[model samples]
Target: MAPRTPLFRPNAYFATRSDVLFLGLTVFALYVVETLVLFYALMYLLLDQIRDAPPALESAMNEVFSTVAVFTVFIAVVALLVVAAIVHYGSGGTDTDGTFADAVSVAGWAYAPELVTMPLSYLAARREIATLTFDGSDPATLQRQFEAVQQSVGPASFVILLATVVWSVYILAAGTAGTHDVDVRKTILPALLVGFGSFLLGVT
Candidate 1:
């Protein structure tokens, strides 16, 4: 049974499958934030590399493009999963009569959270979590230090992965059961999802 008073009456389709759609949208939002934070971070590191060696211009460009491509594909896969889940839930948890448009729409909102979160973020905190910079005079030593920074990305990324999962579950539950009507409840789920999502992304 639908709520007597609609909770923040969304677009026509949103009302019909709010639970699934919201969850999908939230995760997609998180994904975009994670991607963007990574993009900026990569750009920052690449700039540093260029600063260190002006002669390696071609190599730097190639490295930047290759790195971006790999991460793009990785994020695309995550987006696909969110879209699929949305479609699965939108059609009342079955693929029997799902529409491609439904999934596409879900993917569209993924970028919204990034716009909202990026400006307000504490860049100082994010920097502390992400990078371990060294300014030693020896090239070999700096290279090793860079390698160490790269290695740390994995453990950092894993922690972010865990945060994203937990936040997803929490937001889904809140949006579904926190209030019969969506407009009134002080839903903590969205904030948690956004905060943790942004943090993980900032670190990445």
Candidate 2:
């Protein structure tokens, strides 16, 4: 189905059970991209400290940390669900009150904008991760490296992040309004609130 508004109403073309579809898309974001990014970053950190550490130990560490990334997916799923529940309750007085299932569908379909945004985001982030280099083997050096990663936000990365947030805000508002059977204005606050949450999580 063609989108009603390619720039805003990203979920307009979606059918039912949108929550599951978003979850699947999130797997690629959280499981694949997020997992590999952190895994490589962690290994990069341990390179010096574990210089003499056994290969088995490193592999074990990798296995352990991979679970951490997986846990982030769980957290995000819960957060999105919570937002959907809010939408259900908040839209109660509308002409057509939203059902819980519809709220979840809204949440899921809201993520549709990521389909267009994620590729650019992934490339920008992957490039940074790829070019990242650190010779810090000592605690002081490692600390600096860690800080660098935390603070490293170039213009391109910043632009991508801004784009994601802006796009997500509108798409989420559109999704919530359509799914809840309400005016778009009524959903704006909810969308902005959830958009902020996703931004903090680095998802949007």
Return the TM-score for each candidate structure: 0.44, 0.68
What tens digits encode model 1's per-residue C-alpha lDDT throughout 1-204?
443222222223344563444555565557555655656666555446433444564466568767876777687667555543543343343323334444433344433333434443325324643444454456576567656665554443455445444444343323332222233133234334444554555455
**Model 2: per-residue Cα lDDT over 1-204, one tens digit each:** 555442544446433223444453453354345445644664555454433344565566668677866776677578667877766666653455556666665565555556566567656665765666554345466558756766667567677776777786776666666666677778788778877876676632
Which run of 10 residues does model 2 get worst, by summed lDDT? 13-22
lDDT of 1 at 108: 40
Question: Candidate 1 — which residues are off by over 4 angstroms?
Answer: 1-13, 16-42, 49-54, 57-62, 70-74, 86-92, 95-104, 107-111, 119-122, 125-132, 135-140, 150-204
TM-score of 2: 0.68
lDDT of 2: 0.60
Clashing pairs in model 1, backbone N/Cα/C closer than 3 A? none
- Clash count, predicted structure 1: 0
Model 2 misplaced stretches (Cα beyond 4 Å): 1-61, 93-95
